[model samples]
Target: MMKKWLIVIVFSLVALFLAACSDDGDKASGGKSDGDTVNLDFWVFGSTGYQELVDEYMEENPNVKITINEGEMNDMHNNLFTSISAGSGAPDIAQIEVSQVEKFLQAKDQFHNLNDYGAEDVAENFLDWKWAQAQTVDGEFQIGLPTDIGPTTMFYRIDVIEAAGLPTDREELAAEIDTWEAYYEAAKKVKEETGKYMTDTPQLVYNAIRDQQDLQYFNEDDELIMEDTVKEAYDFTTKMIEEDLIGQNELWTPEWGTAMAEGTYATMPGAPGWMVANVKGNAPDASGNWDIASIPEGAGNWGGSFLTVPKESEYPQEAYDFISWLTAPEQQLRSFEIAGLFPSTPDVYENEEFLATTDEYFNGAPTAQIFAEAAKSVKTVYMGVNYAIVDTEISTALVNVAVDGADPQAEWDAAIERITSQLERQ
Candidate 1:
């Protein structure tokens, strides 16, 4: 009887040990599986067919799941700031505009340095200026990849030009208007012949010209550099108003929309995507009459976005892998084909499909080729953290000068004073 009881006790101990080992095995498997099934949150500003692309990626990579959160352009920036400050519930990846990059980089410690994840070496794939926008003060990479870039183009109505008896073909226009000086001359001709304004607003021209400069309101040492290039922008905009090339309506208002539909403006120097969605999408009936051409000054970048990972993310490696894939040249090409975003990768410029593509909305013009060429020559500019504030003050000053007929020199002096004071306070 004692031997039988000892046997039963030994069997029970063996069974208990096996059960404990099974539990440990299950825990280990769960931990490894969690890495494969990482749940990533991503944020972007546009309702510009991003969901379809995300859905396609999920279909291809079933192991990973992405939840996308979108908001208005300005609201997304505000949300990013607020969420990063709290350091909790922040998205793994976020889309940041070029204008806002400097502002976000000021709180540099809040974001994962992409240089640590091997983003620095691949910088050669993007435009040099665009690549620099993602670097921190110490030359550390804070942004992962450039999703899109805006190489400016002049989207004009071919029919309108013909009606106005102006040059219709790209070559003719290019020959007649090789510089901003020639551009204004062509605009005067269009106005006289077609009775339509050449542009929507003087401020739009100002913004486009301002983006072409290599240095904005500040320098590398953070000192205000408010001479030369900036003065040129102000002077050019003032001349546009003095020459009556632009209508007085503010952009984004009902007045602007009405004028666009009514064909009050003959040409618009606009971002590639916006030119499609805003001008062509709003007036689809007017399709086949519009065409795109290179900007007068050869090329310049306007707006684009970079994807960044917050430092507090729980899965940095997974985030980096996903980001690298999404912004890869092939993936960006695919995205551009589906969406109207121009490619940021340098290699895409060589792809025949990218260079030869035509938009039905723009009278079947090979706009992609024109924009790609222009993007190659784009200049890099340093936009300091306070760029938005300074830009706003300068824009307001321009409005006073052009619209309210305020003294050009006096307005510029006051604007410089106000911007300098504001920067000091910050």
Candidate 2:
């Protein structure tokens, strides 16, 4: 990014020199006049397909030129954090993942509050939970505009379920596993008929149930709610593990791919679109064997992102203009069309094209509508600044019990202690 900026500066200087060297009338000689170009430095992370979008935006607005630097999500976030702390070298705008967004809330003042630029007026355009995630209590000091949302839906292996003598129909299977209890019973039947497990691992099931709850680890006031909701979620996860319904494989690993390809699991409880894509990508040989369904209980989200303008940006208004346009309903729809990033905008849900789209990977299933309905139905969760850390602590507790034969009660007590200790330090 620095090198690109230096080159732009040199090019501007050469343009000034050429103008000055030209023989003109008594009019103002060639020296660079006031620069009108809004050169914005944008850092995008992950497979957002923003490069093409930025090219389109630049072509439409010749006066504005944006330089996009892309990298992995973790790298981009680390760089942004360093720059923010150093008070220099930050990009005009950057992408932040939902899980990591809470970390920035502690330094909220470092961002250009989108609310100051009239972002609240279009709040209805986005899904309520996504919009709420980036704002303060009064909707003041909103630091980001919602982009792609990850609404949870079930993905299952049709062949595996059929092999277990379960209904192969999507709606019928949906009814069969409409609740966690039903899902476990179905798992038992599947295991009895065939040696395959019901799902990948206990942690995912734990997370799926935890995400759906109104309060998982913390309340809106940042009070810990472990004893009430978290304990129950853990207990359910432990029961599944104890019953041997879950396979002992890590997500997104070679073992996971092999399991999918071999039809070792009958169902995935609820997953984001990208995670479902991950499943499909890893097991392409199993094409036409997998499909999506409604989440057993209801909707929950596991992934998404925000586009934020930093306070250090010299072109704040122009940057905001670019992000607002990028995250707007029309552009979000384009993104989904290009990259499978489910739109956060509810208005796009009514688009006939989106509703009618089907996936061959799921045997021409109407996954588009499935995801859109789940997107709107998601409950709003007010995660505190300590969410990532606290959630990880609890997740580790589940892992300990599953892998080490640790007592569930003991693990739960340890998780609470870790969360309280870590959050207090934060």
Candidate 3:
């Protein structure tokens, strides 16, 4: 009877030890069962060709698999907000546009503090302003890495400018139109001589000028700052219309497409990607006639995105590795060479291959070098959460001023009211 009791006691002890081990393993794996493969979901705004780039990285590492979920810009923003609020199956990695950083940074704890993973060294390679956009109010670094940058340039048709008796070469045009005042003068000359407006619409001109500003729409305390900047943008655009330098057309409509295709506009200030798809898609026949130059201002950036790791990710280290690799200087250079997406890495600007390359689409002009020079001079600004709302209201106000002959000061006041109201709700 004594031996039988000892055997039973030993068996019970063994069972308890096994249960403890199982519980510990569950905690370690974030409730995932043993022997299960770890899958990471990555979300991007659109088909940005990151899958092909990531596939090459995965081929050497079989332990990790990445699944990309692509959606429209607005849809992706909504999805991120919903998933984050629910504390549910959010993506391990997500792309956040520069303009939306303020919104996401508000929930600072929802994202992994990237500084803990030695991302600070990588952050040093980017421009000061670009890197600052990823940090929270308390100075906690939240985002992963910046993949591409928006260094705006004036992409023009060499043939069109030549026909208008304007400077056709990049250097001459850059020199002639060094300031916004000079740019307006050139626009008037182009319109009067060739009957082609310098831009597609008043909003386009306003957007370009607004990008050149240090403060837009709002102040440091998030109060509406539209009175001065919006007034300036509206007055400038309205003057362009009054001076017959801007063509009257709706943006993104069939009429706009027709105008671009038929050379109704001579120049457009936009990012490098616009040259690849939007402009090229609209006017494929005018390929070799196009070229890129620095914008009226020395430097300005428009749109770009950063990859971030969410706090709920099961595999934070893996996500960080992938995000860092994707935004590394070497990888960004490859992306620029393949997709015409400009590199955010300052070191990539020194690359001889990037600086020397010429595009056949732009009459073999060395556009890479031109953009690289412009990217260096770009000044960064703090874009707040209600940037979109303010942008929309201001655009509407500008349209009224430019197209409807509305009073510029009155439109500016009205825009201030609307933008301030919208931002206050946020």
Best model per lDDT:
2
The local lDDT score (0 to 100) that residue 298 gets in candidate 2 is 93
Candidate 2 lDDT over residue span 135-208, tens digit each: 87777678889999888888889988998999888888888889989888999988998888899777778888
Candidate 3 to truth, TM: 0.91
For candidate 2, which ten residues in a row score worst on lDDT? 23-32
Quantify all predictions' global Cα lDDT against the true fold.
0.78, 0.84, 0.78
Model 1 lDDT per residue over 264-343, tens place: 77777745554677886567678777788777776667788998988767666667777787788888788788777777
lDDT string, candidate 3, 366-423, tens digits: 8778777777777767777778898887778777866787876787778878877766
TM-score of each: 0.88, 0.90, 0.91
- By summed lDDT, the worst window of 10 consecutive residues in model 3 runs over 27-36
Candidate 1: stretches off by over 4 Å: 1-36
- Give candidate 1's TM-score: 0.88
Top of the candidates by TM-score? 3
Q: Model 3, stretches more than 4 Å misplaced?
A: 1-36, 403-405
Better of 1 and 2 by TM-score: 2
Candidate 1 backbone collisions, by pair? none
